[model samples]
Target: MIKLTLLLLFFIIFIKKNICWSDEPHMIVSAIAYYNLNDKEKRILNKIFLNYKEDRDFNDPITGALWADHIKSNEHSTVNPSDIRRYEILDIFNEWHFVQIPYNPTKMFLPHYYLNAHKGKYNAMGVLKYIYKILIQVQKKPRHGTYFSYNFYLRFFIHIFADIHQPLHTISFYNEHFPNGDKGGSDITLNYHGQIGKLHHLCDNIFYSRKKHWPHINPSILQKEAHVLMNMYPPEHFGSKLTIPSNKIDFIDSIANESHQLAIEHIYSHIPVRLVNKDMQIKVDQHFVINLKGILNKQMVLAGYRLSLYLKDIIANIPEDL
Candidate 1:
């Protein structure tokens, strides 16, 4: 009986270790939209996203202690200052709003269980973290007032909005083998175009390929859909409950396994179909309306809605009218 029980445990661990993961393409589209806006708008958006990125704990210099190191190292370089500033802004946004979850392609594995375990809990912390960042920023530059910079505010607001919408960003995965690590869905691997790739980028960029192509959609319709999907699953099922931090291997393993599964399901379900073409080329029709373009528009709308929500919160805290 003892031997049998040990075998069963080993089997469960084996299965858990080999799960696959992916991110929804629509989310990437939203991110792109937030990132690609003109300079006037990009600066404001940068501030909001930058705030969130700073709040998240990452190895990057901007958010980490090494940020000054990065600056000192690059001070002598002849690179464009504007570009560097832009990159700095984006780096800051990515750390807090985007969790770089581990993922691997070529294994055909999914980490649904890992993501599900952290659905509700880690996400709330992320939200609060972002909110707290905004408050700090406001307090630091109170003299700037809410009217400080519309462009900056808009850009910041939109990016963070999308961040919160990404289910993986909100949850965490814990496991005895890898305790307190939130790789999102990056930890899983999948087969893509005959090569191994990370599941996190696959889901973040490729899942909604159509959106990148189209880039326009009715904002109202998109918001309705995102809201419905986000609210579809209960927070607890997604690991919403707060808990005391610990390093128990088995306990953490269970959470990671569950969170991975949830992230896969939630992202896959909303992946826009237009973005799913095996070939990079899209079929053009006589109607002058590209099939993929239509899909892209829908994604843009969804992104816009989510962006609006995130911005609304940040904007509210500011003392000026945006």
Candidate 2:
């Protein structure tokens, strides 16, 4: 009975969360981490990455991170059918990029079970760990599947790590008004600068436009930006919450929880609560932009730094014999 109620409730509030940051934001993350990788690590990644590279310009962390997103093409929609990556044709695996932790996950029964049970399939945290299992299989043998080889999974490794850091991606608020959760914030609308838009869309909007290409910033600038923020909020800033990681899974969950905490304390707190209707129209105060910028900049930097460490750990450990 409880499971049925929760499932029914979920469908009622199911709004797809926008990609927390756009393609360029994801690119920024990979690019920063790529800067920190050693020459040998770069060489290894370079070799594996060659499988997906089409143009000579495809050899950078930004490009590599963008690789996962580039699979999506309106090419097929154009006058001439454009070349689509083989994998995109198979499955986008969109749901693997995030998990909507309820306002109070500990208090919810079915939601908690669904989270643990469907981590790999339905949650970004599970898929992040699942990459390791796939890597182990790749190291042992090849041709397990034609399309999804080690390189293919590497694309997800680059993308999903960055995805989890976006606060909206990691959480949703549930309450009397939103019995099924706030649909990861998409179900709520805010009025900003005379325009009304979904709150999640606004949080995820990093660049000025929606064009598929990256922002016009240089890679060096992004790396420096990422470097600066990583130092600003080091491990010391994180409380016992981040310090007590018992295993690999725990570490990722810790990060997710961190993201959730921010969604509540930093992101959602600014909005006037009574003003938040099913699709509330809100005008943010002048300080809201300042706070949002600070939050986003910090998350992006941490995303890059942690992504680098995690990716390096996996790539560095892949057996030489394989």
lDDT value, residue 113 of candidate 1: 53
TM-score of 2: 0.73
Highest lDDT model number: 2
Compute the lDDT for candidate 2: 0.62
Candidate 2's residue-wise lDDT over 136-209, tens digit each?
44553433433225566777777888878888888766555665667677778765445456777656654122
| lDDT tens readout by residue for model 1, 211-288 | 221113344454454444444432233342323133222232333334444455544333322232222222222121
Q: Distance (Å) between predicted and true CA of 220, model 2?
A: 5.7
Q: What is the Cα-based TM-score of model 1?
A: 0.37
lDDT score for residue 147 of model 1: 32
- Evaluated at residue 114, the lDDT of candidate 1 is 42
